[model samples]
Target: MSASERYTFREVTPADLPLLAEWQLRPHVRKWWDTAEPFTAQKLKDTRVKRWIVETTQRPFAYLQDYSVHGWEDHHFFSLPKGSRGIDQYIGEADMTGKGHGPAFIAQHLKALFEAGVPVVATDPHPDNTRAISAYKKAGFEVFGSSQATQWGLILPMKVSSSS
Candidate 1:
């Protein structure tokens, strides 16, 4: 990505369900995500999770969701500080991965959250998901805890601070 590259996120709408479902079933995405079933217009109306279809002005290519770490009672990221958010996302387009879109878009989104007064951003990726770990590292996230097994699966907790 270049310094001038642009990224944006728009709230997922009911009209986006089919495309999201299509993406969720792709080999590239299906390997890491299983989000197709509950992805209805009603799911979009949930106030807790802020879901977005990630875009690059040129086109949309991914799905991303961020929510308060404490929103769920037993979430792996529950120990993060107040106002901290946890994110899960995947590139829908096979061509978009390995091209730096993950880090670039994630960093841009983190910047927006930080500017909006979020003190920290956290993510817990499967321990073996090297691609995701690498992208999060490039986005300024650092591993902060040992990997643990939870309802979400085995995750290696990672985080980035607004002040960092």
Candidate 2:
């Protein structure tokens, strides 16, 4: 595990659409993520979520987004603590997968969130996506319950506390 690997994040912007489009078409990414349309201009303007482009020493290779758990009415994470946030991300560069980057970057991002006074950070991976589940575990998230369907999809909710 390259625990020492470093990554940087910058907020997503209109100029990133082409890279995002190309990445979304890759088989590895397309398998687990929603359509490229999710990052529409309207989304960039949304106040409830923060979209980011993650890069390592190599290049910009992933997309990560964190949203207020209560941002959506009746959201499944609604019952979590008031200061809780939810994360969803994917490695856009296929070559970057299985390289220990996911957990390393996620852990770093979680640290930033906690430092910013977030009480908890949550994630819900698709039930069948074992890769994501394993990575989340490595990054310090604990599974809360079995897979369950929600307005989002079949999710295996997991979380890490600021105290942890």
Candidate 3:
């Protein structure tokens, strides 16, 4: 579908944990993950994974994965300076791919984050994923530069500078 079509954002919840876990196990999610391997059985057992469900459920948007902690590094890419929400997102559903929802979805949240006092927001996709790169650009993120790959991390910094 084109970006003109409508979509809704649902924050994650405890009730959604099983589904989230299932999604985590998908090859698509695993492909771009920061982890070198698929999430381990013990890793899945960890209580912290549940937090992605809780925090996003409370927030104004859906989470592709957690960004408030653990994921983003302390650098220009993940850093929000003073007035930013430091948000991240993903389109977890396989059916949602190549449909133009990602740019619109991200554009919505990026605007929201800016309104919430964010001065900048950044996301990094795999270097080889041109589709995601295009979607990020369509959402108004501009590439900054490249960095060394970390685990499943690839791609470069694509950032939006807020007007606040």
TM, every model:
0.94, 0.94, 0.67
Cα lDDT for residue 31, model 3?
A: 66
Q: Which candidate is the best by TM-score?
A: 2
What are the Cα lDDT values of the candidates?
Answer: 0.89, 0.89, 0.57
Worst 10 residues of 1 by lDDT: 29-38
TM-score of 1: 0.94
Off by over 4 Å in 1: 1-5
Candidate 3 is scored at a TM of 0.67
Clashing pairs in 2: none
Off by over 4 Å in 2: 1-5
User: Using lDDT as the measure, what is the rank order of every candidate, best first?
Assistant: 2, 1, 3
lDDT (10s digit) by residue, model 2, range 83-122: 8999999999888999988998999899889989999999
Put down candidate 1 lDDT per residue, 42-73, tens digits, no spaces.
87887879999998865999989999989887
Write the residue-wise lDDT of candidate 3 on 29-60 in tens digits.
65665434434445545542322321222333
Scored by lDDT, model 1 comes in at 0.89
